[model samples]
Target chain A: MTTQANTDGIVYQLRDLSVNLRRRGQDRQILQSLNFEVRKRECLSIVGPSGTGKTTLLRALAGLIPVEGEITFQGQKLEGPAGDAVLVFQDYGNALLRWRTVKKNVALGIEGRIPREESRLRVDEALEIVGLQKYQDSYPWELSGGMQQRVQIARALAMKPQVLLFDEPFGSLDAMTREGLQDELLRVRSLHEATCVFITHDIDEAVYLGDRLMLLSGSPASLTYELDIPLTGTRSQISTKESAEFLRLRHQVYEQMRKAHGAAPTTE
Target chain B: MTTRTPISLTKSGIRGNRRHHDGKGVAPMIGLLPIAILLVIWQFLGNPHSVFFPLPSHWWTAIQGVEQQGNLWSSILATSLTFIESIIVAALIGTSLGIALGSIRWGGKALDPLLDFLRNLPAAALVPAAAIVLGTNTKMALVIVVLSSIWPILLNTRAEIQNLSPVLSSSIINLRLSGWHRLSVMIGSALPGILLGIRVAAPLALIVTLLAEFITNLSGVGALILSAQQNFNSAEVYALLVVAGLLALAVNSLVSAIEASVLRRHGPST
Candidate 1:
């Protein structure tokens, strides 16, 4: 099921994006001057220490956070919540509305602007793409954690977004379930060829999935440095994680993060 | 006796329930014995010639009188209509106002005090003042009922819509939903709260209508009860009171069932 990206290659362009949250008349710049670009069908993994504004950065790019920078989508300025980017929240259970069945939640991804029949068709097709065709009518609570996350992914896929932003979507699941989901995510994403940006603290996840990995510093968080990961073939938690190159990249990312946090590394 | 030790006298009520559930069918009937005993006491206390309550035999006759003469049907019908009219009107107005108030960020701060002042005014206290304007009829009854029933509906609905998970609000904005469309989602989404409010308002409708009837000289079950009391016809008074309680129960059950259905339809599936 091939879909079209809105642009020739570039999907979302954020130039000098900075988010400042004001509380009690005090200015707290959460993220400052975060410049990034997400190309079509590429995943950018943002790894940082906790409270480094990684999540806020994604929110800003998705137009959820109010920022001063010029954030453009398909050559148009994104002033507010726009359709080009879909955000997958960390809490998959809370993200999907419990009032709806799996099929209905997926259908919401298509939105209500289309004709009812056409929207239903798109919803059913999305469920199929996510490999949950048979469980369309199942409620989310009844499913296992992986299935629930799949339903969420199906909803994001239903939007047919040019760019997808995930805020630590798999951060809460068990080791086995989390690994399984990452596989499912990559599999379905490749099939759809949708642009994606995901935030995580896991170094291995950064190396495994991210085409470009950006590490952020803490408190007045800014992008310190970004690296490009060039790995081909089936990427799974178990298989590629043991590779020499993957470990080296993980080591590089960890060092950058430690430096950002201002922690002195003990030499043995 | 001084040297003797005491045993535990505490009755494990919940434990008894669990044991009872494990037993045969006969064990369940014991729960109803208390209610049966209470009814017997009520029956004796309510003897027709008794000083306090009218007799059951006397009430049977009054009920028979209404059934035989056919006018009982009209009077009951009249009262039920007025009661229902006031309640429906209140529900519609209150639900609408609540939804509107709930959406605005400062709506609660703006309207809470005013609503509190009006809702706290007491339905019965409003009788004399309302009677002066409404002039002793179904209109007066409806006015009282509306005042009593509308507040709970309005307040509950506001709480439900306003307190929705912030994420859903973001979802609504992200999707670029229109104003009317947003209300449809929010209202239906607020089913559990609105239903509970309606259930609360339903009983108030009956109570207010009964109280309102006391202010009016027109046809109603309240009017019948009043006349009976004036004439010292205790049996008739008791009989009319019975009918009123039964009517109230019926209305309460109807509203409850409707609320349950709506909740199931709109609420997240368990």
Candidate 2:
């Protein structure tokens, strides 16, 4: 079957995409019929309760896992990891190469593919983007949780990817650090001009960072809610979060998440 | 997050050597006090005529005499060469075998029984068998040492590979690192474990090397000790034993220093 031509702004087009995985010697369905379009250059925030197969969905989108039904990327069938896509993991400690310095880790994906000079330049640029130029020589283990996460992000950014798939990238950080990184991500995303699929369970984070939001919930998780974030212009953590529109969107997402998680939604 | 904690906080504090660095190198100096006291006591009180326990000055004289005879340096070199060669061979074989078996889902299981039996066989017990089979040559001694010392490296590497974080594996895939790059990353991640294995195997390798030499009557320090005993030269025998002890101490210190220097980049293991 042929997919639509790549003339449209859509980067990822999914149709009845289902994923059945082998878990503990049993074939379990993790994602069921997830149909959506990830728009070009848009931050698509996917929020869901814990254990709702949000990571599984992100894996399917990254083409890192097998999925039933159609999932097309830029009018082509998505198979193994795409050349222009990179992932930033939440467990930054494990995701980074502890043996390597921050600069070397950032250069990992792009090095040996490009010329040595270009690779070095790209690593320097990525570190600058993450505000980690000073820490380029330090190992990841020597950094704090927030800085380590930035290293992971810097590693991804150095690839100059078309799609940045983040799996709860700031979920482990403290609230203040998470907010700071969220702003930094917005700036980096704009500078790099890459589409992002950010997975998170935080309602406020989903609303604050997303250009658009999609929720995956229930046992065999599927897209249960979708909305365009109305708050526009430059986003600061304090002002944007305190704004009325941000509060409204955050509340709507929380209510939908409560229903999706099988918790009774209160009228109040 | 901007301020870094003291490096000692990251390392095990129970070790006197580590505390030595933070405590102005005083702990290790203090640690040598008991040995110094014992040596002083022995030097002052021990009889020079005792066959079993000769004076410290006599041991020095005996060792000097052996050195003058030209047997001391060559014997030490031979033993050191064998020990070094066996460790290198064992590390290569062990790491390769470990990565191969650990990568495959069923490889380790298939060889479980054989590995268990081989690893349990005493290194000393295998010395005579190896001497008979390989005719007591350097190659035979190498095989015996490697057979005993390889278990730690192989086992540690395998466990590390098996326990490699899934996030790192997925990151490797997502980054689309080429085959060579992937292997480099894999080896880099497993290096700490491999180094740990080498640290454990160093002492075992030394013991097996000495045993192989002693049992096979090969030309090394072990042979010198054996010959000194046979000739009823108690002073030379005691001197050679002290030399052997010094070798042990040196190997341990060297290996630990190397391990620490390398692991400094990799961070303290967990």
By lDDT, the best candidate is 2
Each prediction's DockQ against the real complex: 0.31, 0.81
lDDT of 1 by residue, A7-112 (tens): 4577777899889988799978998887887787889998887667887787777777689988877667878887667888777765666667899878765556
Clashing pairs in 2: none
Candidate 1 clashing pairs, residues 3+ apart or interchain: B46-B54, B47-B55, B48-B55
lDDT of 2 by residue, B17-83 (tens): 3323334435545876897688778889999689888877787899999999999999999999999
Task: Provide C-alpha RMSD values for all models, in order.
Answer: 8.4, 5.2
lDDT at A232, model 2: 80
Docking class of 1: acceptable
lDDT of each: 0.74, 0.84
What's the lDDT of the predicted structure labeled candidate 2?
A: 0.84
**Chain B TM-score for the candidates in order:** 0.82, 0.86
Which sections of candidate 1 miss by over 4 Å?
A: A1-8, A22-27, A109-111, A262-268, B1-36, B44-48, B69-71, B265-270
